[model samples]
Target: MSEENNIPSNAPVFQIQRMYLKDLSLEQPNAPQILLEQTQPQVDINLALSAEPVAEGVFEVCVTGTVTTKVGERTLFLIEAKQAGIFEIRNVPQEQVEGILGIVCPQMIYPYLRAIVSDVCTRAGFPPVLLTEVNFQAMFEAQQAQREAAASPTLN
Candidate 1:
């Protein structure tokens, strides 16, 4: 038992402390008039991910999605949902931490954001808008590429 005391723990630790809806908003400018339209409304979705360090080993990640449905020039319904999670990331390399926060954390919280958007649209008297699966890895790669390009000097 005395020999075990000499050993040190170097295992990585990552956990979600809590997940909650940080913000939500629903707007129906056309309302009854828009509902009367016989044509199918077009939907446009926008997504964003953000991370902030709250404590020494704790971070907050937010996944935000906005859905807008329009019938011609008029608006049918617009809903925005923000889902956030508090994560504890310790014993991890500093360089890898950014990727974990950008890709892994957002992937974990995106489903909840999608559900909220669908539920809000359905409850507001519209068909449930099923959100497609997002590729966080690709997004992260693109952002990194853009940063690298910006930092490099233009030859022209």
Candidate 2:
């Protein structure tokens, strides 16, 4: 137990650092008539995740999604969230860096994005939307496993 106390105070730290919108897209299938309709709309949401390195020790992860709701094709509401974060990682292994950016940082930054999406949707004349939680850790593991499988050649 005594050996465990020797861990340094400043170890490899994982932090959100900062989050922003790298890009965003919004489309209304029936904008003109939808603007004139009055009804409670049902919504459908889709989420997408992507990560890319900008520079050494710096990376950007984008979590984007679309919300489409229609009052019989009148397009009651539609919005998209393109949330991204710039993470500063140091002292971690190179192989682990992708997981850090793709999984960890995005998990930390998602709530803010969710709130933003909910608020934007509500303020845009639609009901508030609550996005479901994402499992980034599991996603990371899956990604790593896929990469490993791809790298290994099969003897046919």
Cα-based lDDT at residue 98, candidate 1: 94
Candidate 2's C-alpha runs over 4 A off are 1-13, 35-42, 72-74, 146-156
How would you encode candidate 2's per-residue C-alpha lDDT over 1-156 as one tens digit per residue? 136776565567555667887665556667677777667777788877888777766777888867888787566667888888877776688778877777777787788778888888777766688888889888778878998999999888
Judge candidate 2 at residue 34 and give its lDDT: 72
Best by TM-score: 1
Q: Candidate 1 — worst ten consecutive residues by lDDT sum?
A: 1-10
- TM-score of decoy 2: 0.73
Give the root-mean-square deviation of each candidate in angstroms.
2.6, 4.9
Residue-level lDDT tens digits of model 1 in 1-156: 236765346667799999999999999988787677799888999998899999998999999998888888888888989999999999899978999999999999998988898899789887899999999999999999999999999996
Give the total clashing residue pairs for model 2: 0
Clashing pairs in 1: none
